[model samples]
Target: MRKISPRLIYFFGALGGLLFGYDTGVISGAILYVKRTLDLTALEEGMVVSSVLLGAMIGAMSIGPLSDKFGRKKMVMFAALIFLIGSLGSAFSPEFITLVLSRIVLGIAVGGASALVPTYLAEVAPAKMRGSLTSLNQLMVMSGILMAYIINYAFSGMAHTVSWRWMLGFAAIPSAILFIGGVFLPESPRYLGRIKKFDEALAVLNMLREPAEAQAELQEMKDADEVELGGFKELFSKFVRPALVIGVGLAIFQQFMGINTVLYYAPTIFKAIGMGDSASLMGTVGLGTVNVIITAWAVRVMETRGRKEWLLIGGVGMAVSLVALAILTNFAATGIMSYVTIVAMAFYLIFFCATWGPIMWTMIGEVFPLAVRGVGVGFSSLVNWGANLLVSLMFPVLLQHFSMPIIFGVFAVMCALASFFVKRYVFETRGRSLEEIEATLRDRANVAEDDSVVAGTTPIAH
Candidate 1:
């Protein structure tokens, strides 16, 4: 195995994340312009905002098998092309339908990249550095958000009608970079192994690992490959049930905490709390800034603190922040309470950035075995985007009837429950090879079986 520079892996992985960030965040700014120019009603506004998520749900659901069959690199390139077309189409969209359609396409690209990129990074990365390298995805995403905010602010006064077009159009630049950058990236070694292209897999592994390690890694992959590959039915079969549960659970929990609601509508939320339009915009920028700073901190702590610990910390923090936010909202009649809400939001952002935001992706990428990784991550991502759609679609309605306090309170309880779920169900994969983790799970299961037999109890399969 030839050893590649860590810098190269980090660069490519971060670029994939940049695409995720740019595509997802760009819409938040563009929707305002789109709604205004089209004279959209509440329903129309919801459609415009939720359309991309609908596309993402479809993309996330379907892209896994495509990535598995076609190779991660090719699928990513295809996604970039989709994003390019979506960006251009959205920028020049003359009608509501066209804009919605364009965003759907962008969502597909975003969804595919979201599922594939972290899996690709985790597969190629050395075990010791995997957390840090994979966290680049989140960092790039936050960077993309920050960049979008900056771009929107810079173009804020440039003929309001066209400014949104420019915002949507700007994504093309990063899409092009991702397309070009992806060309040079090697195919995932696991994908190669799954296809029985052992020599090619070995060569790719050699690039990422020491020669001795590469040889052993190849053997381990081959042993694991004995399991069935592909097909939706395979995902539910006895052997793969545990993996399916973890993947899907992670996906749903990641979104049910209401992170996207905060990300997609931070400006509006701040405005509702008494800030002027300009101050609200600045507040949104502050949210993005905090997101980026804490995401970087997550990358650093990921390896040190481990995934499970960070998740616990983040979940606790998120719950606390949300509760505080709810309290502030309940007291909004007092003008000073707005500042309290801002502080609560900042804390929420910090918790999310440091824990759930990055760790969720990293855990999803790591938990699945290579044999079923594509379907596992794909389905998980599908659930993720699906949950995102639900949140985006209902946030306006929830805000209208329940008040911010009730809405955020619901999210806080959900987050706290997620933390408990993690402690009970999530296994630690830190500092271990994929094969090693798989072996441990198998061993643990076997031990339970033996103990069950001796005690005359039924052993849980998972």
Candidate 2:
């Protein structure tokens, strides 16, 4: 067999992300037609949108332990296959309930890919390239989103009976590609070492690293395994608790910042501002383009400039822009407000794509020790999807009951709080080896305990 290049591994192995992006983004457009076709109420529409998240939460929980046990390669390919099945099932669903069922099935693949893809990238990557490689997962996600936006706009012109079906069916193509491409990838060497396949792990590592470097990394993996392989209990230990909080907190705040509210419902927002269907979808396309471009640039510079700085920038940018957007929506309600909303959204997405959008996944991949990377990411992802579910499910209802300004005002506040959390909690992981990060977390946990004990001592008030 030919040796696999790191480039192929970086690109193709992240196929799961591409499938995830396209699958999720396509629904935004599909729902426009599906809601009309079915004559659905707002709650029913939210259910159609959020059912996938419910599946994703369950899927995120299930896939981690399985990947840790079966290997990342197999599980990723499995997700691709499941995604394809779900896409086809969704396209053919005769009614709303059936469509929701299909979306939940597809959501499993989305959640699995979300958790596993970055973990795979982190494991194989040299410390220097880790952030960039993991960010490619985010890149593919943005590309998938962009691809979906274009498709949705193109298909919107079709007859109503078939337009949404075409939009939904388009997801199957990328799912097929991911399934086929994932077959050619190697298992994570860390995972192999965890299973005691020493020789095989070394063999795979050799492909990714120079002979000397490969052996060194293999040793590191062995050491990591000894640090408590698949140690779920270890995650809550004092030494590792902060890492868990950072991971889960980042996940929750990422969603609460309302990036998905924009991605999943940009067209709806545009429409409310007086744009027609074609124009609103085009607005999404513009935003999607920005997402891809900004994310691409962020990953390239991530290791150079660092994740923490960009996250702070994103926090400030999102909060300001969302507040601006909220205020502008009122102008839109009564008068022309195109430039204001577009410019504000552009700034908001630029910050998010650069920081939280990609950095969140990149950090999650690095934050956990090898022993619990899978489960830790899974837990974080569950929070992410759970937050996503709440936001998507509530947007329509909120719109019906509250003003756009108030809803986005809430998002802006969350973004500000999320920023504060990042400055206080999220550690910089741009160029650090996963093992180095793990060691730091372990040390921190130890120090925290020591601090507690010393505080309790008091020396009899002497």
Candidate 3:
């Protein structure tokens, strides 16, 4: 095959992200229509909104091993097929249970894509451009969010009750495209090497790098696999524990900070702050717009600003924004803080877009060695989706009983802690190759013999 341009690889990667965004975000608008059509209560609405997350948790948990064993390309294609089935199933569901089931199925696809697409992109992209290329996943997600919002707006006012179904079924279009596109794309060179496909791996490497560099890259990949492949048990081993800590911590902190809570509940948050239903829905479009713009900015800065710095900036900004939000919401009954709450949310999102949003995904891909990369990312993502379900499931209850002030305050504290953790433990990975990172980790754990033991076998007491 002729060498695929880096640009082409990025294009397909973003296309995959587009499907992810559409599958994940389209439900936001459909929830209201489905609720009314199905005669759903508040609890049912929560269930409807969270069903996909349940599916996502399962999907995220499984995709890692499947990707590791089967290759990223095949797993992604399978995810696309799942997405297609889920979209069609959801669009034509005759009952609420069916719709929820479809959403869960869709979640599986979303979960898989969330784990695999960025990993594939990072492996294929040059280290210099890895941040930007991986970031395209976020951009595509935003784009999907934007597309869903527009489609929802267009369909929300339609006279027919079936309009919402159309809004949702539109996701299948992108899912189909992704599935077909994935069929034509090459598998990750790293995965090929793992399976001992030396010649094929060399071919992929040559396509991804200069011809002169392919042999050396293949050799490095082979050398890195000399150690035992990582498993669940390896997660607790001395060599892998730090990476696991970072991965799981990143996953939990990302959700605990309440970014998805805002995304999933933007309209409701706006309505609670005194905006009318129509106005709140329109305001959500603005949230999507800002999310897209800031994510674009993050893509530009990901490689430029070191990862640790961005996490600190994002953490502090998220905390400040959330605290401001809490204060605003606490007094929203007076109407004075309503607009302030909106602005605070906007700031919170901006900070997330700049830092935690894209960087978390990028860092997850970089932090683990290849042997355990799939499992680590999968486990972390399962935690992320699981946390997503917990928060989404409980946000309504918390809103009703605890008030927005307490809820957002909790998130702010989490954000503060997350920032501290990132600053203290996360390494700067800009421009570094994966092998170099692995070498650094290995060297950090290497044991040095004492001079007395090495020279004469004479022991000295301290």
lDDT of each: 0.82, 0.86, 0.81
lDDT string for model 2 (143-195, tens) is 99999999999999998778999998888888888888888898888888888
> At residue 392, what lDDT does model 3 achieve?
88
Clashing pairs in 2: 239-445
On residues 66-122, what C-alpha lDDT tens digit does candidate 1 reach at each position? 887788888888888888998899899999999999999988988887888788888
C-alpha-based local distance difference test score of model 1: 0.82
- Give candidate 1 regions above 4 Å deviation: 1-5, 223-228, 333-336, 444-462
lDDT of 3 by residue, 249-273 (tens): 8889999999888887787777777
TM-score sort, best first? 2, 1, 3
TM-score of 2: 0.96
Q: Clashing residue pairs, candidate 3? A: none
Count steric clashes of candidate 3.
Answer: 0
